[model samples]
Target: MKRKILAAVFLTVTATSAFTGTDLILAAEKTEETAVQKPDMEGIDTENTKIGISIYQFEDTFMTLYRTELVRYLTEELGFKEENILIEDGKNDQDRQTEQVEGFIEDQADVMILNLVHASAAPQITELCSEEGIPVVYINRQPDSLEMERWEQEGIQAAYIGADARQSGIFQGEEIAVTENQGDINGDGEVSYIMIQGEPENIDTQYRTAYSVKALEEAGVETRELLAQTGDWSQSQGQKIMEEALDEFGNDIEVVFCNNDAMALGALEAIREADRTVGEDIYLTGVDALEEAVQSVVDGEFTGTVFNDYFSQSYGAAELAVKFLKGEETEPVTLIDYIKVTQENAEEILELVNS
Candidate 1:
């Protein structure tokens, strides 16, 4: 008999729900079903099942840490053989990623986990995987609208697991609002700020910026749009933009809200070149609690940041794939929770990541 897979929306549940009774035994812990059901692993033929992961790029520290932890947990912790996992890097190219997915399909991979470089390119991959009866799980980025609608209709084995970019932005903005800026020139209770955005087409950029603007407005912070440039999630690009902003706004710029940690680091470089001290002369905020970002927070370089928990994301996606393969039910959209990381909690976060 063919396995019957299920899909349901349960936003309040956690990632631990992806295992089954057998999985619990293997995991050596009885996880609560109220959090989220674990993917059924019975009769899965683990030795034969193949899983493919397509990521944007492994150059970034965040992606590297996640990939390392995921491989470790999935192979060592979950008892899957290392050879069964195939990882492909897109080199930040959408076409290349699509081709990689095609190759995975041709190889008859049982499941494909994709972190799309371009959301619009997702449909072709989804359609190809669907035609071959292979499950597709989207992570970190939102797929295009039409593709999402079709995936729902086709009952595809898919789940979205990532941070709510908008909410993360709101949190960043709230941090900036309360940050005292002694560098303000006029001392009129207003501060100048610059935004370093991620890739132009990235959905996170739009949502994060929008929610940040909302929070800034609510806090009555007068922000000058000195520089709103796309960093392409590149540290070098961030450095260039920050340099330009420094040349334009000088010490008048009190805050820098970067879309990710790399850009924030770039901004830090620019600030350093200008002889401005971070955390003392100006406040810096960024998303993606990369190890460097956490370290920076502990070192007093940044004010704070939001943690996307990439390890949890990978484990959750793996669990979801197992569940889909087992004919178990899951939600179409599974957004993971995010945590705020500040100096006060940096040690705890560092411990978690290190652990």
Candidate 2:
């Protein structure tokens, strides 16, 4: 088992690590005032305004929190009627989600907040909604950039509200790179990692899988992939993948990067079962800064996780829907910043998540 030698050096690097090659466009900062105040709905009929929300999967820990907050904000804060807001779970099936969206269209929903089951289906979904003149606010799962470009070029009434997946990936890599040995636990001159990703077709999975390694490389650390597998954002799948990776790679696996915390928690179980202690022999990083994951970081079980900022994201989505309803202009793309969570800030984040 190997441990980081200089904790101070690691802390310094973690604090100073910055995003490279892209300007941070934070919608949270832009909507700070609106997030607190209710959207002005002078002539808008709150009780009669029908809202349709379709989550990719209700089982997703992060989106579960997001949908809850989104509904709460729309009703309690924005004065919309609870009965008018209809939410459906897509069950991670694209065809099922398409049917649900069609139903929303048939019901003549005033606005739809969509967490797409397949982001690649954006064009089809957009066409269905646009033909009916239903404004859409897409949340969480981001569509392809080209689709967003079409939204702008054609002046479509759609907007995407989510954090940049690249930032989350960068944070994950920075967490491992800031380790005293840059996650080269066995002094092998390379960080050998197992990547536990979410759905393969999801943009989050793609960006996180690629940019995590990109961040390590940018930090001047050599990296080798011991194994990579999709957990489909399921904890059990994460555990099974980690277990198999451990069996094959053993001590050579210096780090495990999970696209989200549910998988990281599952991976942690696998690591413990193998009697391999994290932050000693191997380090782990994940995204979404889930409550349990944050507590794990505080307890020194995880290297770090990124705060997905569901509060800002959900609120932003709702705000955009309100904007569309009011015939106000909205940017086609809205981005929130993902915050890095480590021992230094884990307790604070845990409290935030709990609240």
Candidate 3:
């Protein structure tokens, strides 16, 4: 249909965020360093090597910032023209994402990166792309291990580039666990808490929800869960959940664990509205050390957050895609690190992000 020399390339940014610091960082490293063996295809390359990307939703605040950084990364590497970069918003719809994938294949893109609306559907997508010889790089929402295994077994040129979500959870939990009160507010040995989760289906949500509480208990505090429900990563949902939880549990709720900064901010708002003071009456924590969240940690309104380092993750994903296009053997998976953001390093991290 469309005149082409080489084939398609797909680069996915799962950045609903994806980095790091701290001695707590854990990475599953895959080493790939070799010479580029240029393909003999007619399409050697061009300045406008079409790059297609599909993100879960544009409304995600962290992903917005992440995609901005990703664009800078790809532009630097590909000199990609504005028109050559096509970004489709799945808007949390699976069918919309499926349609977008079909369109990308029809257009015969050079590369694509996907942040899937449903990571479980990755196998079907991968099979479809492999048939057309398109390499996929999945970012934020990671597919199942079995799906990844299939890709590896079939030698499908697909790679998953993101940080370990479990690390973020562990960091968030450990941050709260180390707090002065240790999440035990009422002089009772129990750490009573509410969990404001992101999407229930997302692995990040599951890990953060479980690990935050696990960390508290591991640090020798007896934990009592008052409530744990999905907030779907929305500020309003988080606020509503916190308000209801406060009303229900009253002074018994010692800590609030939001899976991300948006929910943490929402919980903070509810705490202030209810006239309960943070760092005094209750404690709160979240993942994604967004600017406001970091500032809150500094201001003593929040316990802390896990710094989701978008810069390094996006850079690695984009860098790998370029290597793949140049016919270089690239790692099938790239794992980055996550940092715990607290008053100790909040200022430094804020400056780092701003810089």
Candidate 4:
């Protein structure tokens, strides 16, 4: 085992130490503050503190950016050494993730941040880490509420750091609900749309799919699902699904809701190839205001997207890991809110991402 004493006695006072579970749950207020640069954790011997990060897949556009930010924050911002950070790609396989985590524990990593291949595996992973006294920070894919409850009850050094998917879902739906015709293209008195979903088991997929429609209904827009299929969070899958749906539903498919920007981009390609014009005959929305997606919104090609705020999420996760390593208390769940990106503010969002 390796450790280092704090260079400044007060350096151990972490920002998150003052936050309670309830306070952290209301994360929107803390977003700007959390995203600001902080003192590097050089006082704590970052060179000796091993950090383990496991991503579901590097192929995911959002996760790729997320993990990149996470590593950059840990190393450049927080002063962790390159050799001390270990990242593994699960290749979107549960068994592969399990194996990598087991290896991390075997190597006695100081902390682990996981974007699980399967959120259902949280209980097992938490148990393994807790037994070894290694703190775990779960991100992106959220585990069930009951699993979080277990962590609180047991006082485990485990926390979940991510955005509330429902918020993102509501943003996705409201984007279309506020449209000139309220997404009721062709004056059919109903908004018939296609849902391009990610993984079926992902909570983000479930909420984004359900709440986007719920939001439309809440805004008095009658909605009918023309087609819904799992795109598996792939660009090709999204394009294929959209092409098939367009073939069957044709002009009746008024709006398309994709769970993330990658799928939306693919869906956009399919729509253009089908000779359908967005904002003229159809509308589209997605989450994760990726640079391209935000640009599309600015170009009036995409209806809108929900900004996932990887900067805050990744920074928050790294901050929590530092807190745990310092023996500080952390909220079992820390939720960062999502932001809606529309054509009006898409340029600003694109600037933010680039900056």
Candidate 5:
């Protein structure tokens, strides 16, 4: 089994690394402020304010934590009535999500939190809410910048709140780039990787898929594309696709890159079943430091993953929503930074996820 001699490099997290690109955006200590400091809604009146949450897909691993934390913040921290917080699953369908937004409008929701199923439809969705005079706070998935600008021109109150996805991709790539052999599984002085993507229309998927490879190449490692396909961010889909790739590429498959941890978990199952050991004969990587995926990293089952920081992201969304509800000035786009997760801090990451 090949192992990374540089594995200990990141034992103590730092602002920079040997593989960091000059263009890469630096992560800030705002994560400190994001994790702690409960919101002070002392003067805010949420007595009858209705907060309608529209999730892109409830089955998604990361979104589940997001939605849970969002509700927890609203009720527990902000002292909002549980009955006033209405959440609906978009089920990954744009039309269904549109209908949900329409319902929020007709129901006269005080504010709406959106995780757009299709970011391309942000204009339509935003227009729907705008027509009804409802303020929107987008989370996780960001709408097009043009759409946002249009809203600003129309004097609409809307903003996108989430971590920069390009950063997540960079972190994902850095994990493999810093790994031993540069993730070169075949020992041929090159890396060959299979990519499991989420929905192609999703901006997060596009950035993660692109920047991950860009980061690898920037590290002076050559990569051969084995197979790159969408798993729709589903574990079953990930397992099915991995099974097919194994049959097609066999041992030539050196690495697996999943856009999110759910798909990575699925690929891990298939890889273990096929007797291809990760961090050994083969390697795998993903985002969203999910508990199972983080534990796998600790157990040396995965190369690494990026910690998506659901706690901070969820809180940031709620904070923006409160500002919207209170008619306060909020930034047009608030970007949070992501943390790279490896075996070095897997236990700490596991605590964050499990807690």
Candidate 6:
């Protein structure tokens, strides 16, 4: 993992109004005398607010689905003007995301929703938005420790909305352990697992891998980290990494736990090249219950996956942005729940995704 450096001198503000939510913590800075307070809006006009949605990248199919759903809901359901919503793809580049954020600030966007590439990079953006009095909402990623400290100091009206990444990992790990223990399709009583991680600095990868390992340990499964490599959420990178894992571990691998479905597909190709049947010779699991992954489950090529409700996360961010623009009180953090998808529930999961 790459080491991230924190920024210095974030904009500081003080909160005068009291709020409560598990998703965020509110604190006031001593220097500021007066702070703007917004009332929670159960009903208000949301006709002309401009929102900017900045994503880390658009490379993965699952992310594309998320983006599509967000745009659809914002336009069709929320009645946000098509031109009012700005969508920027960072292409997985931190520098690009920074530039895009600065541009959004210059455009004077009503609210900015971010899925940051690096947690530390948030302080600068947050500081800028704070100075401009624009609320920033984070989705799918949380601010790093330093950023969180600065957030409280700045009295930033922000929310961290996304699935519990560590819990998602634990769910994936538990499913794998249970299946292996039961020897449902015949197992050797021992499981050797490989993890295809996401971006190196991504919080999701860290938490998910940690909890997944803990779950496996608790289950008494002899798990080995056969290959731990950064996929960077690129299918090409996933394919390359899985190819190397295949060359090294080959048939001894009992389970392959991928961070997302695209990489899971890539790993599937590598398994095919080795002439081993997936879900038979070796089971597979992934996060981001993407279309292809769910389809693979229905076809018996993979075992299970975790579903982070991207639609609800995006929708909640948009709703919060509208409220914030209207000077309404909003939580600093809002966490969305995740679901585990297995072959038994693949059809239902697919229906939800499609709907």
Best by TM-score: 2
Off by over 4 Å in 3: 1-46
Global lDDT of each candidate: 0.74, 0.85, 0.76, 0.84, 0.80, 0.70
Those runs of model 4 whose alpha carbons end farther than 4 Å from true positions after fitting are: 1-43
lDDT, residue 61, candidate 4: 90
Superposed model 2: Cα runs more than 4 Å off = 1-35
Pairs that collide in candidate 2 are none
Model 5 whole-model lDDT (C-alpha atoms):
0.80
RMSD for all candidates, in order, please: 6.9, 7.3, 7.4, 6.6, 6.5, 10.9
State the number of backbone clashes in model 5: 1
1-355: candidate 3 lDDT, tens digit per residue = 0001000110222323333332222121111132222223343354667778888899988888778878865664445676777889899998899899889999887778888988987988887788888888899888888888777777788899877788777777787778777878787878888899999889889888887777777788888888998899998998999999989999998889899999889989999999999888898888888889989988989988877767766766676667667767777777766777888778766765665
lDDT of 6 by residue, 147-238 (tens): 66566566777766666677788877876777745322345555677888887778888887788777877877656677788887666777
Tell me the number of clashing residue pairs for each predicted model: 12, 0, 15, 0, 1, 5
Residues 267-309 of candidate 5 have per-residue lDDT tens digits of: 9999989999998888899999888999999999989998776
Clashing pairs in 6: 23-333, 24-333, 39-328, 39-329, 159-332
Distance (Å) between predicted and true CA of 195, model 2? 0.7
Report the C-alpha lDDT of model 1 over 244-349, residue by residue, as the tens digit. 9889888777778899989998888988899988777788889888778888889988888877667567777777778777877777777665666777677666
- lDDT by residue for model 2 (220-337), tens: 9999998889999988999999999999988989999999999999999999999999899999999998888999999999999998877767777888999999999998988776
| Model 1 alpha-carbon drift over 4 Å, by segment | 1-39, 181-186
Q: Looking at model 4, how many pairs of residues clash?
A: 0
> How many Å off is the CA of 336 in candidate 1?
1.2
Higher-TM-score candidate among 5 and 6?
5
Worst 10 residues of 4 by lDDT: 1-10
What TM-score goes with each of the models? 0.86, 0.90, 0.87, 0.90, 0.89, 0.83
What is candidate 6's local distance difference test score?
A: 0.70
